[model samples]
Target: MPKLRVVSYNVRGLKDDRAALGEVIRDLAPDVLFAQEAPRRFRWRHKCAELARSGGMLYASGGLPGLGNAILVSMRVTVEEAWGLRYPLTPGRHLRGAAFARCSVAKVPFLAVGTHLATDDTERPAQAALLAATIREAGGTTIFGGDINETEGGSAWRTLADTRTDAGATNQTPTFSVTNPSRRIDALFADKTCTVTSYSVIDTPAVRRASDHFPIYAEITL
Candidate 1:
């Protein structure tokens, strides 16, 4: 069995305390990191690379191409393929997309998707559907993660729940507005083939200063 830790976070476009952001990320020591709100313009790629290196991880995929999503990986992970998808346009809505990678850790393979759904209630369902479809098309034990911008009862959340295990649901940890911390918008959903070994919302002074949302991680075995 191969056990790996996956983390999902929203960096708020690197407008906050980046050093604290790097500190908390390094502390979590994730194998795969699903980052939402990555710098989307003006040297975005270089910024993404710097962000990944800060945590001793490699930038794998996503960023501008995925709208605001990005994925980073630890050295132990081998990335076989990497790509991104921009979702269909809905009038007046900001674009959204997903970052994907076919990766293997310790020789056990899986597909990793990093995404950020629409904050507008009207746009989330379609984005969620696209995410699910991407996972289906990729066809493997998939690790889906990032900010869905809704609660467990929301339609978009339920749509994703239909095909994957909510690795952080049971913990019921809220992950938004670090100052208040009352909403649970960030998550990690894994295929049934993976067993959840442990899950947690990484919280500390550094995490609070990192971004508006706290990062969540889960230890899953495949």
Candidate 2:
């Protein structure tokens, strides 16, 4: 079986403490990192690009203004396709987007989607449905990760797996409010075709100071 490490983190627009951020990534060494609330400015993207190169990961970030959601994968992984999603309720601003990257871990091809959903109950569910549909259309074992901003048992959470039958959904272990560490706003959902071996919340006190939301880590066998 082929296993790969993945992480979903909201970097807080690169405002995270630099040293802590670097250390977190270095320690985890995730094959794929999905980051939300990342700045969209050129300087910000350039800085992230630099980090991706230096950290041995490739980055794909392009959407609307202000902290565009992004996906960074290891050099060994290949991004075959990508897409963006816009909400009908919110439109133009507060735009939420999702991207699907086709890649392999240890030569095992799999699909990974990076996304950040809305806070509104109805909109969030609709967005989740759209993403689920997008993955089904793509046709393969898929994984979705990012700061969903929704609580456990919420409509959005419910909708994520509503359209897919071959998939198993896992609420990412708690990852939020690095300082206090209360709710779990982040998540990682994978298909039944994918086996989850382990899950972790990686936002130690030091790392918490780096960003508001901690990183959710998981290991999957394909």
Best by TM-score: 1
lDDT per model vs. reference: 0.89, 0.71
Q: Per-prediction TM-score, please?
A: 0.97, 0.86
Candidate 1: residue 27 Cα off by (Å): 0.9
What lDDT is reached at residue 92 by model 2?
47
Model 2 alpha-carbon miss at residue 63, Å: 5.9
lDDT of 1: 0.89
Best by lDDT: 1
The weakest ten consecutive residues by lDDT in model 1 span 163-172
Give the per-residue lDDT of model 1 (tens digit) for 1-222.
888888999999999999999998899999999999997888999999999988889999887887878999999899999989888888887888999999998888999999898889989998888888878988989987989999999999999988679997788889998888888988899888889889998889998888999999899897
Count of residue pairs whose backbone atoms collide, per candidate:
0, 4
Q: Report the Cα RMSD per candidate.
A: 0.9, 3.1
Residue runs of model 2 more than 4 Å from their true location after superposition: 60-67, 89-93, 162-173
lDDT digits (tens) for residues 1-222 of candidate 2: 777788888878767686777678768888888878765666766766766764567775433422367778876677766655554557544666776667766767788777888866667877777877777788877877877887767877767755432122354445778767778878877777777888878757557666888888888777
